[model samples]
Target: YGDLSKPYGTGNPVKARCPPNNVVWYTLESYLPTLVYGCIVDAWVTNGKCPYACKFRYESNPEPGPFISAVNEVITRGRKIEKDRVVMYRNLLVERALERLKEIYWQWLKLSNEDGPSLASLWSTGTVSEIPTLKPFCSLVAEKKQLDKASRTLVLGNGMVRREWHNKAKLAKNFALLPNLESGDLNPHFAKTALMDLVEDAINYLEWVIVWPTVVQAVRSTPDGQSHLDPVIVLDRS
Candidate 1:
């Protein structure tokens, strides 16, 4: 967590982000709305210095002003695959939902007689801004049920299934937690390993979904014509 009151190079309110996120600075993060963060403040450090790169001042409140509670996931562009135009549409949604959530949090603080701004405000400018939508990342439930809930939430938040790719089924499929293939037939010792393999497969599936439309392949391939690494065209999600 860091001070949310100040704007950094890309209009990100979190001072902890830009300096450490240099790799995406020029590519994925050039869009200001997509660069905003979802900060989860630790209580002890909230009253102490900023969590990692402690700013000299604001020691009394590491995360100060307007923002109190936020989902612990960063609203970054690094994870998704969308064309720049699609990203622009998604960014508008993100900005709207983001502003609404922050406003709700700030208002709850005020109505309960806590100390905060009397008005709802955005961290970037301390004023009402656009809203955005996304799945809430944390939940306490059965694993399968949790993934389903997150999937539904993400699809609804995206607001682009019909208008753009029209791949709602594909999106839902990616969100699914795949079941093991005849795990009971395997030895007991393989249970954990099988589960890990499923997890890895799920992540790889997601990667494929994101990168398939416009994945960048290295010009130089191995002798057998296999890629040696993961590389993407720099402008895929700009």
Candidate 2:
């Protein structure tokens, strides 16, 4: 019915024209080679997926070079040094403030008891001249000193450090008022008034030591790290 040597598309009428939507026809000799080439192309594309592979490399890789590790070490050491300096200066300020508080309390106690016991005590003790020597209130002083030491040791800075010192000083000043209270040996009304006056002084000292330094530090923009090393606050972080 057709020329035997002629291909389907050339001369034969048995082959059908391919539909545009569902064409599946192929040349018999070309099909295998096309499939093979397609698989090879897909494999090549998949293998070359990471074009920027160097940029995403890990730091901890076995062959990673030298400079990264050295820089990291320097940064770590610098941070430690800065932290230590901050701690040192904070402690020094706290100690000085505490010592000032102690001196004030001692002076207040001594001034409160100038005249000794009243005449009413003559009946109970016999001789008024035999009054016991003031014991210096050493135990109370020691307790305050211990607390001061503890506060100094605590690592604090910025506003928090200043606030803590102010609070502690206030408490010490309040405690100093104990001798003047009615419950204490001092005359009730007079002692209370004197205590109130001393409390005001305590408040003043706290402002002087804690608030003033903080203001200076703020004005200067002192760094928490190196601020401790310098007696005066310096603003530069470096």
Candidate 3:
């Protein structure tokens, strides 16, 4: 399959540049739950709903850890200034990827939400694998135009049905699992399984929308044959 991450301005696949596969890819699915839980906590704190913490706002501050401190220390240890900048740039990429992941996570949640768009009924069916066939002109302009009662009722009915089918393609594209055939609340295990699935799906999407594009752009922007450290690109999907 053609790499979707690389831009094809000329419509020629042969012209698309493929980077080396030597980058160390970290499997971060194990940490997804914690990251999402943090987003949830952020939301709570932002809304002043957290009892233990004061109201909070999301900030773009670089994440703090021993790794960050080490990077700072290394930069001061007479490393080439260019290499130091590369290290900082890599970390900036990680932060940007995290921001994109957060955006996609909330977007997916809203799309599949109970009352948002995709219907719980349609979600459980095999039909979710296919794009929804929605009717256009679902508005009740028929009534405004003083159409027959029968036509007005039909328009209203279709509008309600279309509302249920809203964003069905969005869910199908971002979500992986075919939802359970049985309809009911999830047990703790099942709920956790679903959350993991969502994270995995979101990461796949991030690779397409954020990771690949960013990687390609950064590679292209660098001077050809410029020597630098072999960097492991941590996507920070969290």
- Which structure is stronger by lDDT: 2 or 3? 3
- Residue 108, candidate 1: Cα error in Å is 3.2
Looking at model 3, the pairs that clash are: none
Superposed Cα deviation of residue 208, candidate 1 (Å):
5.5
Every model's TM-score: 0.17, 0.17, 0.19
The alpha-carbon lDDT assigned to residue 224 of candidate 2 equals: 59
Reference-based lDDT, residue 157, model 1: 17
lDDT of each: 0.29, 0.29, 0.32
Give per-residue lDDT, candidate 1, residue 207. Answer: 47
- In terms of lDDT, the poorest run of 10 residues in model 3 is 22-31
Over 1-238, each residue of candidate 2 has an lDDT whose tens digit, in order, gives 1111222234222347642221111211123223323332222222222222443434424332222222233345542234454344334333333333233333332332455533222111112112221111112222455435331211110011122233343345454432321213222322233233333343334335434546787857966555655666568988
Tell me the tens digit of each residue's lDDT in model 3 across 1-238.
1111232233322325653221100001122333434553243223222223443344532343322343444445534235565456345433433333334332434545544434222222212213322111112222333333222121212211122223342355543432211112222232334333433443334234434556788877887556273455667788
Report how far residue 168 has shifted in candidate 3, in Å.
11
- Compute the lDDT of residue 163 as modeled in candidate 3: 23
Cα lDDT of model 1 by residue, 51-71, tens digit: 334445664464532111111
